[model samples]
Target: MLYRAPHKTAVDPDTGELFTDLLVIVVPDDSAKSALVEDPSVPFFTVPHFDGYNAVLVQESRLGEISRDELEEILIDAWAARAPKELVAEFFADQ
Candidate 1:
C-alpha cells in the first residue's frame, strides 16, 4: 500500500478513480515468486514494474488456489522483509 503521508488513496487503474477493495501484497523475494509461478494450480504472476524484480501480484479471484499454510508463510516472509529485525524476532519467535 502507498503510504503517502496524510491521505491514502486507492485509485482504480481503468477509470483513474478511487477504489477500496484492492489488496497489494508485497512478496519477500524472487524465490517466492518463482515457487508460485512453478505451481501450475496457483495463479501468480510478476509484472514489469521495478524491472520485474521482487514484487508479485496475487489475483483477487484466484486467491483460493493458494492454501492457508502457504499464504501464512508468504505473509510472514513479506512482513519480515520489511519489519525491523528485533520486532520480527520477538513476534515470530514462538511461531
Candidate 2:
C-alpha cells in the first residue's frame, strides 16, 4: 500500500464548509493498474471489497504522479472495457 488515510476532504459548494468523504474507486484495466503500481511515484492501491485485487483506489493527493497523456490512455482503455463494443469501435474508427 502506498498510503492510507481515514477520509478525504472536500468543500461544500453551498456553505463553503469542509467535509470528509471516502476515497473514490477507479476501475482501470488490469495492465494499466499493474503499470501504475509498479511506478513508485503513482499512488495506487487495491481493496478487499468491491474492487477486490484487480481494481485500484486512486488517491486525489497523488494524481500529480501520472502524466495527462498517460492517464488519458489508461482511462480510455478502462472505459472501453466496460463500454459497448459498437461505441468503442465508433470512437476509435480511425485507429
Candidate 3:
C-alpha cells in the first residue's frame, strides 16, 4: 500500500511534534477493497464508515511492533471517535 502523510494536523500531546508519516486507508463501500499496512510494529487506528461496510485505517508506519490486541483497541477507539455523533444517535434512537 502507498504511504502518504495525513493532511489533517492534530498534535500528539505526549510527543509535542508535528506527526508527519502516518498512514490512512480509506475504503469505499465494501471492506474487501481495503488496503493493509504490512508493518506490525507501529500504532494503529481505524474509523468505521457510517454505513458500516467501509472504514478508514490510520496508523504509524511501524505498526508491526504493536500487539494485535492493542492495535485492535486503538482501531476501535478511532472508529468511535471518527463516527458522527448525530448519525450514531439516529441509529440508536429506536432502541
lDDT score at residue 78, model 2, on the 0-100 scale: 66
Q: Encode model 3's per-residue lDDT on 1-95: one tens digit a residue.
A: 23545444434447776457656544333432233323334443443222353444554656676678865654544454457888656655755
Ordered list by TM-score, greatest first? 1, 2, 3
| Candidate 1 lDDT (Cα, 0 to 1) | 0.62
Tens-place lDDT digits, model 1, residues 1-95: 32122113434457775434334556677776687667788666543443356655555656687788877787787788789999999998877
**Tens-digit lDDT string for candidate 2 (1-95):** 22335432334346665423324434545666667657677665544442344456665666677799866776677677678999999999967
Better of 1 and 3 by lDDT: 1
- The runs of at least 3 residues in candidate 3 whose Cα sits more than 4 Å from the true structure, single-residue gaps closed, are 6-8, 28-42, 46-57, 66-95
**Structure candidate 1, residue pairs in collision:** none
Q: Each candidate: RMSD to true structure?
A: 5.7, 8.3, 12.5
Clashes of each: 0, 0, 11
Better of 2 and 3 by TM-score: 2
* CA-lDDT, candidates in order: 0.62, 0.58, 0.48
Task: State TM-scores per candidate.
Answer: 0.65, 0.58, 0.32
